[model samples]
Target: MFAKSTNEKPESIKRVEKVTGRLVIFYEVDICNKSELHKIFKLHKIDCVIHLAAFKYVGESVKTPLAYYVNNISTSLVLLEVMQECRVKKLIFSSSSNVYGNPKFLPVTEDHCTGQNCTNPYGRSKYFVEEILKDVCTSDPDWRVILLRYFAPSGAHRSGLIGEDPLSEHLNLIPCIAQVAAGQRTKIKIFGQDYNTRDGTCIRDYTHVTDIADGHVKALKKISEDLFKGWTAYNLAAGKGYTVLEIIKIFEKVAKRNIKYELFDRRTVGRSWQDDDLKTVKTTKVVGKRYIVLHAGNKNGFIPGADLVFSSSTKNSDYHGEMNQAAKLQNVQTLLEAHFGKEWAQHDNLEWYKNILKGLKDSENENSQDQEYEEEECNSLEDEIAIHI
Candidate 1:
């Protein structure tokens, strides 16, 4: 219930606060702020922490590599240090399958080597944090760690009371398809249609957010019961892979609408820093209560956030040194609106621009670029989102 952005969907927080009363404390505080973060930790008798915070977003990470490293890695370190001070011993980390990169084997297992071929900066950041956790576990057998390396998560809650409210600019498959059905855009663009998989598109294991949450509770109980020490990794996915087209078809059938789409060879675009999972919520089912968990083709792999925070990450600082988040967002939307009709661009632009990186904010990386946009004619929202994939 702690967050920095007072503007990142205030209504959702309001709704939660309304029901929880004083049981759920909401703090609009930044974790990077040692003093503020510590103050909150002091208030609660926290024993175990779920470390799910980090900067994500593949293309943006590539554009701002250092931002990814500092936000994803440094912030986790800071949280850990605070946990140690507060005597929080057990931690469940929200890791990502991106650690496996372009998987060598189907249904990637926990043993798959990571950080070796991570092309995306976001993936590397997660891999590095996993390493840090391993070091922490090895250094102190008292520290119990469980790394949940989950695949792409989708679906919403069953109650439909609280659902995902992702910024309009970037969305996962379901939301994007939803947009198309609503006529937000013309078509869906499949990232790749010629992969080795049967459907030719990249195959990803998707699980419902509810299943993932239940799995964590199970993991916590398991860890407590066994007194397990050190590090253990588990894949929390519906041990099944679905092609982009397969998902589109399902949505189309359910919605009873023709989701216009176009298959593209690839895309070349630019985008920056997205943050974490300790306090992250996976993607919620689009609507209602009771998210029916997808039964995976592999029963063994079946597994499973509001925030759609693949990794519960936060940039320690704005890194870009831009205090005018409101102004910057106006610029991005003004720019996107020109290309993507008015409704085409609606996500809160400054959603990810919070906290300050301190020393790194002033320093510039060689790969970093100014707010620049390369324009190409795009008809569908899919083209806008998938072009950069």
Candidate 2:
């Protein structure tokens, strides 16, 4: 399939490389350009194409509806035209759960009505594109397409090497959580906690990225078979839903620390980017995998390589042990250690300081005091105590 941008193609290439030992060729040509697409199709012996290139920002789609429609809808038309000309009749198109919109019923079935609840241009784009593909496949019997509708994809490959890496700002919840845990972000923001779901938070089915990738392979296999003909749609979810609160709890458990989060009542820039479908993976169960665990002590959070390197450098210093311990305390501790060192651990009255910290910890545990601690309190403490240490 043709990618819209050059930067995005490298990731697609790497993912495709893992499955096939044979040299897999990837070209960076905008699918919106028909002439470029036609030339590429003529060059490759592509039996069937899996079209995944699309502009998928829901909020941005709302602001620039035309770009969303043109990029998502128009690009598909161009790809189909090229395929038709090249005599490639089979295609596996990437669809989304957003087309279903706000679920009329919990655990939405494929037969459940579509296009009615789509809240934004992005959802509408997917809905309209699916309709276009349906018409294209129906009008011509020679055309066979499989529409794979995906849910929230998270968790990199077990190796943690290859996965979704948007070059700019992140828009997905998984990456956002990762950033917070890695300490890149100060706090995790839970957009809505008042949704009519358990825990009052928006719930979503988070499928592992590798599992979703394997679904692509399964669809490709179906296309290779003579029995798999005509157009069909399938929902690729984990067959479950997870509330935002539960996800935070899991991440905190995995990272071995508390994750600070707050409920956002007004900041509803985007509603839950999540979905469930009744069309289960009965025909094509992804082998050797079934469920994803938000495991404890996984130590995965917003920590980037730079932070790791900085922390490691402190560890190698003569005072490494104390620095490492300080870094592990929290984001505040890491900042303190990096700036002030062990002196921050000192106090005019060591016993008084320890007692105060202990009391604060106790009050927080008892949930009696609702006072929020300022980052500045611990921010410069290290520097202040440097002479004492």
Candidate 3:
């Protein structure tokens, strides 16, 4: 498979090579460099392209709007020009639900209006690209494109060899929570807790990364079919929504640990990034077997890897601890001793322990509350989540 490596230290790509024992032909060139990207396309005799390069962080995008526009939009424009020149018209563009902005309705569909109310430049970039692709398709019937608007994609590959390993501070919810559970961070900073949702936290639909990958394969297959002529869009999501606090409780269950968190006044950019009206979606029909299933009570509807133990020898192993024993009581004493230098017993009754216990109790009460209306709304979109190109 052809890919692009932008990071100087592309450790994940190297790990892919090591584990699979297969050569991945990739170029480290920037996608905005049309000549270089064109050469790669011509050299490979490329027939199709999957455009996923973009500056995606919402807060970062708000901080630097020009960078987001230049990188995200420029790369797509360059890639499209090269594709047209190479006569490689088949393309799958990774779009985002952010293009929908604050949802006017629950269970958003492909027909949901875009390019309006986009709260940040990142969302605007995706919307602009989609519009550009639409114009390209209109100008040439030979060009076919698929826009995959993804919700929150989380979790690791089932093999556990690859996962979300961000170089900078964690921006997504799942990774941030995992960092706390793994002791990499002392606590998770919840952006807001005063929204209008049932739990007063922003609700989002999260799908497994594997499922998101599967959606791409299905999109490619759909575009290759002769009947699939014009450009279309689909939402890749679990069709269920979860509050930040709910996810934390679920992660605690899966990780067998207490996740400490503190709430702060939400930033405008932060709210734009995640907080919104219930943002579940009824996905378009992709030509493939359904890969997503939602079990009762599990909002994410997938197995999470928070408790996964990694060997220290693995190149990507950032956090190491005993398997299935990460939060055992004995380990707590060990952790205290390590921190307090053998005088931990004297501070065993410290207020910190009481606060943690209190947090756990508060979390339990929050999770136990039922949002029947929201659950029903999400269930209404379950059957539609089945992908059929």
- Point to the candidate with the largest TM-score: 3
- Candidate 2 least-lDDT 10 residues: 290-299
> Can you give the TM-score per candidate against the true fold?
0.65, 0.66, 0.67
The segments of candidate 2 whose C-alpha lies over 4 angstroms from its true place after superposition are 6-22, 266-389
lDDT of 1 by residue, 31-119 (tens): 78888889888898876778666654554676788988988888788888988778787889898888876554444568878877675
Candidate ordering by TM-score (highest first)? 3, 2, 1
Better of 1 and 3 by TM-score: 3
Give the 10-residue window scoring lowest on summed lDDT in candidate 1: 269-278
Estimate, for each residue in 213-332, the C-alpha lDDT of model 2 and write its tens digit.
Answer: 889999889877877767888888887898888888888888886778877752333345333433331111112222221111111222122132222333122332333233233444
Count: clashes, candidate 2? 11
Q: Give per-model CA RMSD.
A: 22.0, 20.1, 21.6
TM-score result, candidate 3: 0.67
Residue 189 of model 1, lDDT score: 73
Best by lDDT: 3
Q: 228, model 2: CA deviation in Å?
A: 3.2
